[model samples]
Target: MSPRRSRKTSFEDKMARLEAIVEELEKGGLELEKAISLFKEGTKLVEELSEMLRDAEIEIENLYSEDDLNGD
Candidate 1:
């Protein structure tokens, strides 16, 4: 599979998981260890999401630059 396709799939999956994590956290009756673990996972997801967004933004910019170069 193409890297782009995989990344898109991963992004979607990560977002869904993150939402689930947030919902679970919000319900708030878990053991302290479990809550902390969920928080850590959520934090990691946020970082990954941010990085993916940055990479996408850069790709978009590059595409526009290429278009300009081609006089499109």
Candidate 2:
């Protein structure tokens, strides 16, 4: 039998794009047109991802920082 997959599919990719967009905006070098477009895209991506997270909850395994991986 195949192992079942976990983690939100494409979730990390969307987050990466959003981070890039914010970085571009913060750089303050983009032309107004490009900045506005990136801002719009970033807002949309944030909303979509927020909705995805809102629909579910998952226990995080904070193995790197805390013992027992958190509030288990």
Candidate 3:
């Protein structure tokens, strides 16, 4: 297992890590325990990424509404 991480990372960094995990999983040589662990981590990253995108969508909608109100 990898050492625990203490520092905060950006969304892009998380995405990159997720991508690496996916590539590793796709190669298909990991033991069951390791595969399960990677799968769990990847799932969590996906949830976080989804939430971030959802929040961004809401922000964009708000900006459009404000622009409409101001006749921009």
The model with the greatest lDDT is 1
Please give the CA lDDT of all the candidate structures: 0.91, 0.82, 0.83
After superposition, the stretches of candidate 1 with alpha carbons farther than 4 Å from their true spots are 55-72
Please give the lDDT score at residue 35 for candidate 2.
94
Clashes within 3 Å, all models in order: 0, 0, 0
Winner of 1 and 2 under lDDT = 1
Error of 1 at 10 (Å): 0.3
Q: Over all chains combined, what TM-score does candidate 1 have? A: 0.71
lDDT of 2 at 29: 83
The sequence of per-residue lDDT tens digits that candidate 1 reaches over residues 1-72 is 999999889999999999999999999999999999999999999999998777443333454676688896
User: Residue 34 deviation, candidate 2, in Å?
Assistant: 0.3
The model with the greater TM-score, 1 or 2, is 1
- Model 3 lDDT tens row, 1-72: 333332235577889999999999999989999999999999999999887667453333454676688896
Q: Which ten residues in a row have the lowest lDDT in candidate 2?
A: 1-10
Predicted candidate 2 versus true structure: per-residue lDDT over 5-47, tens digit per residue: 3344467878999999998899898899999999999999999
RMSD of each: 5.2, 10.7, 9.1
